[model samples]
Target: MLVFFTFVILLALTVTNSKQTFVILKKSREDWILDGIGLFFQGIAIPFFQIAVVFQLYQLLLPDTRASLNLYPIAAFLLSFVFVDYLYYWNHRLFHTRKLWFIHQVHHTVTEMDVLGTSRNTLWTSFFIVYLWIHSLFIYLLQEPNWYILGISLSSALDLWRHSSFSPTVNSWLYRCLSPWLILPQDHAWHHSQFIQGNYGANLKLWDKIHKTYHKSDQVPDSLGINSSLSLSKKLFLPLE
Candidate 1:
């Protein structure tokens, strides 16, 4: 329900922004296919994999530990939103390294801020993401995972928003409140820019700041994404040197 609401809000924002909507509509056919397939894999297939494969494997390997965790609701939420988020911050940073950039570069190919391109990546890229494993393990171990699940849903929704051009205005109260701590759309746009070296966090800017990787800017980059000569097949399957 929350996820649905978030989608509705993002769609409304995109529709209301004529320029943003035009940019989205103007995406190339290859962009459409890559983003569409990536979204489907991440949104549908990954969750199914988490449940049917990862969670079940945990059940088999740790049979006696199922629901062994009895954390308070707030603790559970923080476990996902803070601790796991911190882990993912590093996970995302690692993807920018030369060793792993091949698998992650496809995601940064989006030339604009559009929610549809949020999940753009090679099909198997999810396997390397920390969320795929940590989320399932925690869900399997938590006796009452409602709060944790809420955290996951909110994080996913925020990812969609931060990847899109649906941010609150800089002069607005909402932007003032969120910009100080949270990762915003413009912040992430910098991460997706031609110089994709910083702002690797998904939720909070704290990790990036602490690690001295945060690129503070009020304006979006003049240019976004890197030029890749790789064919569609390579973008979807093969990794480059």
Candidate 2:
């Protein structure tokens, strides 16, 4: 999935330079190293969380046990997507609070938008992300583990597009139609905005609208990220600090 999006962004960059488009054309080596560390953390967190999810599911599904809710597989799959998105909506907002803000601030350090920026969270943030911790449990309870994985995988692929600097051609009618339902690149860019708030949904804009946290504007933000005085090491060890 990462390679595929990298190719798409490269192709888009060839057609439109970063200045005209939202795609960030250049990234520093330090940024790449930070992203690598983030990925390393993600690698560790994924297996650990998966183990916990499996253990929880095993406890729920003992020898003679049945699922708590047995909806049709298709319905369960669809509902899982909504459930995770809803979970993420609130959890993401919480991360912006004073307590969790420092941990999440690593990702926002990027002054530009790119696919790699999506992976740029702190070492522990991935582990504590609400969706990662609970989404699998919801999948098991719904009795749609396979379908749920597929749905979330598809949703995640779409999320990669949201982080890109690329935008659809103005002539494309499909872009206009789906712009409202899905989080487009520009909409998400504002979420990374230095001075702006709102636009906090991941895959769908429904929750943001319902919660009145949605920021609807075509204007790009003036800058990205907060001005921090902490040293790099201090920022990385923010949780402990």
Residue runs of model 2 more than 4 Å from their true location after superposition? 1-26, 43-48, 52-68, 235-237
Candidate 1, TM-score vs. the true structure? 0.96
Give the clashing pairs for model 2: 22-165, 23-165
lDDT of candidate 2?
A: 0.70
lDDT tens digits, residues 43-90, model 1?
Answer: 999999999999999999999999999999999999999999899999
Question: TM-score for every candidate vs. truth?
Answer: 0.96, 0.80
Candidate maximizing lDDT: 1
Q: What is the C-alpha lDDT of each candidate?
A: 0.91, 0.70
Residue 1 of model 2: what lDDT?
A: 53
TM-score of model 2 relative to the true fold?
0.80
